[model samples]
Target: MTDSMLKIENLHAEVEGKEILKGIDLEIRPGEVHAIMGPNGSGKSTLSYVLSGREGYEITRGSVSFKGKDLLALEPEERAGEGLFLAFQYPVEIPGVPNTTFLREAVNAVREYRGEERYDALKFMKFVRAKLKELGMADEFLKRAVNVGFSGGEKKRNEVLQMACLDPSLAVLDETDSGLDIDALKAVAEGVNALRGPERSFLLITHYQRLLGYIVPDRVHVLSRGRIVETGGPELAEKLEAEGYAAYVGEPEAA
Candidate 1:
């Protein structure tokens, strides 16, 4: 058994009394990329939100542990402080906050939490510039408002930049591939792949296996009806790519 970085066992959750995730069990260890593929409304985003300690979700049963610490016990910021990052499917627009300011605050906050010295402004800007280069992005993006008036691909790339800055141990990327052109998708995949290492892990929540063609998960899990119905190696994703989810998704066909 591999030592787990994030473990969710039989997790059941709801929002406003409407059950979303039902009995979700997954384990991700360091250096492993685990892809969760399902149709829309299969509770994919819900799982990411719940794991990140987002508000409005109720966990009715089961448990989640990150690095052997009780995940449910941490507040959202606390979770981030502990090196758990969740990249949202839809990046929110912070109208008044410049992307640089938001990222600097976030990076320094996590650093402070970990008892590390904060970066000086110049040092931080240099750090961010290098990350952008790695992601095939330019420096002009740092001057814009966070997700405000940015293109879809830019927003997703910003999310990747944040991931690079924070260097989280576990990254839960919810629909990171949505709305990207082939080039943008490959860039995002390359960013993710660049971050892969023996001490890092990822939970890639996506609807299609196309992104898998780039990142290539170590394991592929089929989620249906709020539960994981099947799991296999990377070949499973190739199979799903060819056959589509209908042949395997046991849930009542998504309405």
Candidate 2:
């Protein structure tokens, strides 16, 4: 079996003729957490979208492997069924669908794909209840429409809830801390921490080091102008927090 949950080698991608990721290389092993920090348009979100198999982005070159499987060959739904999850920076609102129902269907779909037995109504509700409590969310949230009119913090919290329910092997959080208040930020962090285990890994993409203070990644990489310019430990986040991204904001490495 492969030791890494996700491996990206010389990944190059573009959208609308504009290159985004330029020869990026990264490896994520199980039980590890990595943070990618950079200024706006530094390919952090592009990496997340590319990993999740979102459309409209073209892969110019390189490879992405999840558990030794060719990630680029799989569809978006296939990626999810294979235990890859991406928490969007701006979660969308799905009106007319109750949050609980949406989550139950999503979970059951993944379970069915894995050839696992589907949950009954009571069993699913109980499972969701426990997960909600684990995420410090209220029962009332289940009754509301899926992210419809939800506050910024609420949407992020709900994203965590979904992640907890799914129990993915590799989770990519793109700007999850954006627009969250201090209290909500802690709640989101706590929820993420609860899901931390040896079988799981995370790639956290954020602009500020404050989220890193809560998540405390095992490593940090600075992405600049379409590639990772610097890779370091937690102290790199502190340095960026102190001095800002100016230190690493320059021309990307030659391809």
Predicted model with the maximum lDDT: 2
**Model 1, runs deviating above 4 Å:** 250-255
Clashes of each: 0, 0
lDDT of each candidate versus the true structure = 0.91, 0.93
Against the true structure, candidate 2 reaches a TM-score of 0.98
TM-score of model 1 relative to the true fold? 0.95
Q: Candidate 2: lDDT of 139?
A: 98
Model 1 lDDT tens row, 26-102: 99998899999988878999999999999999999999999999999999999999999998889999999999999
TM-score of each model, in listed order: 0.95, 0.98
- Angstrom error at residue 195, model 2: 0.6
